[model samples]
Every structure is written in structure tokens, then in C-alpha cells.
Target: MTGNARSEETLLLRSAVDRLKTALPRTWTLDLDLDPGRDGTVTAVAPDARLTIRTPSGASATFTIEVKRASRGSVRGALERLLLLSDGQPALVITDFANPALRKQCEELGIGYVDLTGWVFIRNDSAGIFVRTQGPARQAPLPDGRTTATKRLDGPGASKVVRALWDVTSTTGVRELAQRAGVSAGTVTKVLPALAAYGAVTRLRDGGVTDVDRRLLMERWTLDYKIYRTNPEVLWRLAPRGPDLAYADLLATDLGNDPTGRTIAYTGWLAATVSLPEGNYPVVPNTLLSIYSADPGALGDDLGLRTASPQTANVVLIRPRDETLLTGVPLPVPEPQIIADLMTMGGRYDELATQLSEATSVRTETP
Candidate 1:
């Protein structure tokens, strides 16, 4: 075994021993057979290890696992590399970086991952453990306005394409997708390649989407969704007094199911409550109200909402990307669009985004 692969396996073994000691019952012992591979490379061969858990009573269970270090910076590259690995056992991706988005990608790809920082999630028939610790900030490691701002997916129009890609539930080509999304052919042309580059969309040689990688799509979309086209104008409105339903009911009366206008219907959590499935979000809607308006300046008067300190602000007023966003989609807020918006919310929304994707996505085993 090469020194790098050998050393990497030793470290992974140590982690398995440590975590399994607690996971397994009392008086149970754990042993690992790690194969660093003939070439001392993680990808040279997939015959990595066979682990066994033996109890004091001689009840033993054995399973297979592969340990590999994640190549830094390029999640797409990491996934492509992982795909080349042998499928004999579940692969454990050990990296120093514990990026939630990357973790999501690993899950979507059906690959198990663990970061050196002690964040780990692995599963097998014999035993499974799920522990999430803070991983590195690789999820958005680059500074603002760097690579993402320049990408073709960084716009509202491209978002239309993304929505169609995820929500439509039918195979589509460029022209078909463009017409379905009501976007220009150029926008679809530009975004599809970008999506394909990340392994989010599996395209035929002729470029039809046979299947979409939901994890990759969510991870990539979250990276740039907020800054994509425009930052929504935010204002907080203090709640006077009422049930949450009463508050929403007032808006419903004015909007009347039209999600766009001087004061169009709300989108994020509020919209999810009124439109999408339950348990899609982690928490109930916060006191903050998100509203979209063409004439936001005049919005406060009618809704009894007013600009307040951001901390105290309860209303979030957004400028529409275009009325198409509100009217064109079947849902009050499309699933992909909601996931993008939640990604920027900076709370437990990332988890919520994952749940929403799993709830909406169609998962099939990768070839």
C-alpha cells in the first residue's frame, strides 16, 4: 500500500473503532480488515475492508466498507471519483471538510460520508450510525461574488428551467423544457450544460434529461440562488395581535390566490403552508413575513405592516423577479424555488431543504 492510502485507512479505522465501541453493546468487540489497495490509492481498487462485530456471547455480524479521502474544493469531482469506485460495499467518504451541501450530495449519490471532525453518517444491515457535527464551511467556501455570480444559472430565468427540471416529473429535452418553463431557448441552453457539468442532470449523448440528481441540484442551486438575479428588498413588520391563521387570512383576501402584484402573495414558509406538503420545512413560519410587491414603497399602508429594525422586523418584502414567477407555476411557490429561498435563510433551513427535496424528488439507483 502507498503511504498516503495506508495512512488514510489507519485514520479511518481508528474512527470506526472509536465510534463502534460506543455503538455496539457491552462486551462486544470490533475488528476491521482494511485493504489500502495494491497501488496505495483509494480508487485503484475497491477491496477496502471487511468489518466484524463480535459479542461476548460469540454472536458476530460482519459487513463491508470502503474508506476514501474526499478531494477538496470540487464536489462534482468527488462524486465522479466516487462513481468509479467498486460497488461491493458502502463507501465512506472521509474528509476534513464537513460541508452540509456536500453531505447532501453524498446522500443523494447513495454514498456514505464522514468528516475527520467527527461528523459521520453511515449505514448497513449490520449496524448504522448517524452523527452530525460541524464540518468545514466548504458549502459556501468561496467568497461572495466569486464563481457563482458569473455562472449562467445565476438568474431568475434559469430558475424557471430548474423548476421544470425537478418538478415536471417527465423526461424533457432543451426545446421542450424551454417551452415548458416559458423561458427563452438561450436560457435553457445555458443552464442545462451548467447543471450537467455538476452531475445534477444525467443527459443522454443527445442531451435529454433521463434523470436528475436531486442532491446535486439542491446543493448547487443553494450556492447562488439568493444572489442570482437580484436581492429581494427586506423589511420587518411587527405583529400587532392575532392567530397566525388570521394574519395569513388577511393577505389571502387581498391577493385572492394571485401570487403577484403591488402586494402579491408571499413565497417562502408562508407559501409552503398555503400550498406545498406538510413537514417540508423544519420549523413553523417565523414571525417574519415575506411579501413580494411591485410597489413595495406603498405596501405598508394597507397590510398594517411597516419598516422596523431588521431584528424586530416581521415582514420580508421581495421585489418580484417577474410576474411569471408568481403566475406561471402551479404551486403558489414551486418546490425548487422554495428550496433555493430556504437555503439562504441561514437557520435550520438547510435540513428543511433536504426534506423538501426528498419529499419532491424521485430517487432511483444510479447506474
Candidate 2:
């Protein structure tokens, strides 16, 4: 580490330890010792600092502490490095911030962590001391004066990457994923880390996506995405025929094969009715037929759909927020997107989400 960098890390560690001391019970005593002799070159051998804690009864324990100032996406890697650096001793990781997922990982690994946001977790069996605290659910600013923003899967680029993940089960390369998602490599680069943080996808050391948890990904996606809210749509009733006949007409239209070069597909309730087994979701009257289209005006005209009030509308011509929704995705959209759309509707559709999740969450073995 450079002299300035080491000095900054020292300051961070001291500030975090001070916060820990303040957060401790009145009866507890806390002391910090910086390992000045260790050059930090072989960080795997020596921790950045050591913490000594004592109870009123004089019971005490010492914990090796490693201070890391990392981005939110690197929290897991920081935790894992702390584990290696601490060996089998009682250890703690002090970072700029630690989200609940990373905190839970620390607890599961039986290690301790403290963050600048006042979040802390520590336990020592011999000392009979357990400490855990929660600060605000926000990231502190970096030394360079930038707030670490959490990545979200709500945007069109992220949506494309997410849908690509749903289609493949094998250990997929990032470039391959970009190609598969029909997005730029940069979009995949930004989205993968966020997806990993959400426990949706696992990445190898070389940054290849090795696994995907479709159910978890779908659940997390719904937290940020909504069918009606994320995508723009205009309500229209399909002539005088009901949604079924209209959906049938939609199938016959084969918009994917159109020479006009517009991408289109079914989604939500109407898509679920076709994808799910018969009777899994009954096609009741007035069920919304959601169609994603590149050009809603042209698609409505092509399909002979007319604008109607929400009460009378049986079909919705949706202009997707980005072409990612339609590009490279299967006709009728992917099952996960269908499930997400159902989840966005809430109410009775929540049950359909669960049913679709159970029906399609089968993983194919990676060769």
C-alpha cells in the first residue's frame, strides 16, 4: 500500500473502532491497536489492526481486524479476503459499508464485520460477547467524494441481461451473455455485479457467470420493475371479440415474422394462459392481453385494436421502455418475464406468479 493509502486506511479503521466503542454498552471497554510493524505487504499474515474488548466482569477477548474500503459489489470478496487474512482467530472486517446480504454472510461464516454506517457484528464464544448494530440503509460517501450507488435491475439494459439469464442454465461468459442478452458488453459488466449482490447470479474469478437462481432473480426483479409502470402502454379493446379470440388472432398475425421489422410479443395474463398448462390459469373474460411492441401505434393499427377506457379495454399495446424487452427474447416473452409481469399486477396474479415459479424453475446441467 502507498503511504497515503495506508494512512487513509488507518484513519478509517480508527474511526470505525471508535464508533464500535461508542456503540458498546457502558460496562464494556474497547481498545484498538494498529500493527505498525507489519508493512501490509503480506496482508494475508497480519491484520490491519487488533481490537480488545472487556466486560464489567473483566472477561475479555481480542479480535484481529482488517479494514477494507470497497464498493458495495466487492463486499463479498472483502469478507472472503478477511476470512483468509484472519486465519482461525476471532476477526472483524471494517469497511465503508456492509449491506444486509453481506452482514448475513458474515454471520453465517461466524466472522464479524463493522461498517462506517454504524452497522457492526461481532461474537466471541470465550468472551461471551455478541454485538450487532444496524445503521441507515444507505452507503457512505467514498474518500474521493462519491456516494456508492446501489445497482438496480429495473432499467431496460438490466432487464435485457436478466431475461438472458433466465434462458440459459450453463456457466455463461460475460461476452456471451452480452451477445445473448443483445446488449453491449458494458451493460452486462454493470449489471452482473449488481445481480451477484442480489444473489441472482454467481460469477467466477474470471467474471464468467457460473450460475443463476431464476426464482430469486425474478423475485428481486419484481422489487424494481412493474409491467404497467416500467413500460409505456395504451389500453385498447380488440374489436368486439374477447381476449381469447384476439390472442388467437395475435398468434395468426405472427408479428415476429412481419416484414415491417417491428419486434412484438405477448406478456402478462394472456401470455401466462398460453405458457402455463391448461387450467393452471383460466382465461376469464376481460383478462388483459398485454403485447410488447416497438411501435404501439402501428401495432394497434396492424392488429385492428382500438383505444378504449380501462374498464372496457381487453388488450394493451405496450411500448417497451427499451428494445431489450423484445430483441432476442422468445415469442410470448420468457417465462420469468411473464412471472414478473404477473407479480407486478399483485392481487390474484400473485398466485399465478407462484404457480409459474414452481412450474418452470428447472435448471439444466452445465456441460
Candidate 3:
């Protein structure tokens, strides 16, 4: 792991301990055993921290945990690494984000672990605790202090890179991968490091991408997109003078066919419910239209879009993160992006969000 990677893991360690303090049941007591001598440094290599949990009736167990920068794509290997330094004591594995699949392995093998996203599983002969809370929803790692802006991985370039890594089972160089993903080489250069910051991508000796934790990548992406990514979208509605599709087609044709405009996409009830069938979600008819556009006014003007009252709006115009969103999917925002965006809407959209999330969780690749 690189220095930044190590720092990221250490930060996650502190966060996990803090969450442990708050996540404990009122009837149970948990102590963060961060004593000076036992700061989880075992021999030359110590675990992240030592934790002790006690129930009111007096049962208690101490666990020294190993917090990885991220799960290294192998649950057994992670379990082994923790046990090696733990001297046979139970090992708890944690990552920057949780993997339910990994959590299942931990439970089956009697190992304990938690992902930053509120998924926790711990079991010992004396006590067992299982809880799932909403995970951290930050958009990206807090700026590393060296740069003014945080790394962003929500755009189309990122989608291309991430999808290639997730769907294509072969390895490719930066330039080749860029060609394959229909994105610029500069964009590939930009996205790889951002993914690496969270241990989502591993570079080859040739500085090419060799491995990617697609699930972890998406999980972290959602956390940041839901929490921090700027929504430059300016939502407005117009009572259509004609049919809703008439206006939608106008905007889609204008933006999608623009030879010299930003790459755009669409998401909202119509895109998710009608254009994309993966979500299988029921939506109100023509309730609203959302598009990924840098120049919505230009497109909206053709369709006679006007300022819609929040209560009576028939369309939503979103500012897109980047061009990568338009590459692979029929909708402006792809599945993961749409799912995360919908999650933030909170209402009937929330129901659709859940459906989209479940669908995307199983098959992230576009049909």
C-alpha cells in the first residue's frame, strides 16, 4: 500500500472505533482499548486497534482487529493476515466500505468484521453482535490537504473505467483501456488515482490497471455521490403545451445530438421506469423529466420549459458530473448513478431508489 493508502486505512480505523462507541447497545458496554502500549501494534506489525465489549451481566471479550486499506478481494487471505498477528485470538476485519458478501464469509468462518457502511458482524463464544446502519455518505475522501478539490469518480470517464474493470474480465493498459471505454486517455489517468485513493484499483508494474474491486468501487462511489458530489442540477417544470415525450424528445435530440456540447444523459421517473427495464420499478406517469445537461436552458427553450412550481413541476434538469455518464447506458445517468441520485430524492423516489439499488447491486453492467 502507498502512504496515502495507509493513511486512508488509519483514518477508517479511527472512524470504526468511533462508530463502535456509538453503535453499542445501551445495555452493553464497549471500550476502545487504545492504551499507549496496546495501540494494536503487535510485534513489528500490530492490528488496527484492540476492542473490548461487555454485556451488563458481566460477559466480556477483547478483540484485536486488522483494518485493511480495503479487502484484498479474498476473504480467506484477510482472515489469515489478521490471525497471523493476533496469536490465535479472534480477528475482526474492517475496510473503508462494507461488503455483505465478505461479511457473510466472516460469519461463516467465525471471524468478525465491519465495513464503514454500517454493516457489522461479530461473534465469539461469549457474545455476538450484528447490526447494520447507514454507512458514511461522503462523496470522496476529505481533501488530502495537498489539493484544494477532492478527487471525483462520478463522471462518465469514471463510469467507463469502472465498468470496464467490472464487466470485462481482461486487463488493459491506460491508453488501451481508454480507447476501449470510449473516454480520453487523460480521463483514464485522472480516474485511476482517485479509485486507488480508496483501494479500489491496483496498478500493474507497468502502471496499468491489473485488478479492481468493482463492488468496493461502486460502494465508495455511492457514499460520495450521495453525500458530497455537487448537484449542479436546476430542477424546473413546465406544463407541456403538448405531450411530455414531445418535450423530452426535443431535449434528448438537442443534447444527445449536439456535436459540440457536453455529453449528457437522463434520469428520473421516466428514464428509470420506461427507458431502463432493469429497475422494474413502478413510477407515476410522466411525473417529471430529469436530464444530464450542461446547457438545459438551450434544450429546454425548444420545448417551452418554464419555471415550474416545486409542487407542480413536470421536469427536473440536472447538471451532470461528466461525459462518462452518457457512454454506456440509454439513460443519461447510468444505473448506479441513477440509483444514488434517486436515493437522495427521498419519497416515492426513495421506493424507486431501493428497487434500483437492489437491481444494480446484482448486475451493474448495462444490458
> In lDDT terms, which candidate is top?
2
lDDT of each: 0.58, 0.73, 0.61
| Candidate 2 segments whose C-alpha is farther than 4 A from its true place | 1-8, 18-23, 36-44, 66-89, 124-128, 133-152, 166-174, 196-223, 234-246, 252-263, 270-288, 295-316, 327-330, 348-360, 365-367
Tens-place lDDT digits, model 3, residues 1-367: 5988667777887787666667777788777654424444447665666777888778878887777544244445667777776777767776765544455566776777766557666777755545545553432344455521135655656666666655444566888888877788888777766565455666664657766665556665655554124555565767565336754466555556666574457776655575345436465445666666666667566566777766777776666655456543234555655655665654577677666555655554545
Candidate 2, residues 241-342, lDDT tens digits: the string is: 877787677667777667776678778776676777645654333367778888778877777888787667778778777665675323777777888888
Candidate 1 local distance difference test against the native? 0.58
Q: Which regions of candidate 1 fall more than 4 Å away from where they truly are?
A: 1-152, 168-170, 227-229, 242-249, 252-263, 276-282, 328-331, 362-367
Worst 10 residues of 3 by lDDT: 141-150
Model 3 stretches with alpha carbons more than 4 Å out: 1-67, 71-76, 80-89, 94-109, 114-122, 127-150, 154-160, 163-166, 169-176, 182-216, 226-235, 241-245, 248-265, 274-285, 319-337, 353-367
* Model 1 Cα lDDT, one tens digit per residue, 1-367: 6988678777866775575455445666777766536446655456456556666656555444545433223565555655566344455565544455457777787666555545566555444433344443332223655532125455778778888887544577878888888888878776765565455665654656766767677666665677223555555565565326435655555643435545454566665555445544445545545565555555655666655675666656666665555452223566677777767765565555665666555332323
Estimated TM-score for each candidate: 0.55, 0.70, 0.60
- Indicate which candidate wins on TM-score: 2
Of 2 and 3, the candidate ahead on TM-score is 2
User: Clash pairs of candidate 2?
Assistant: none
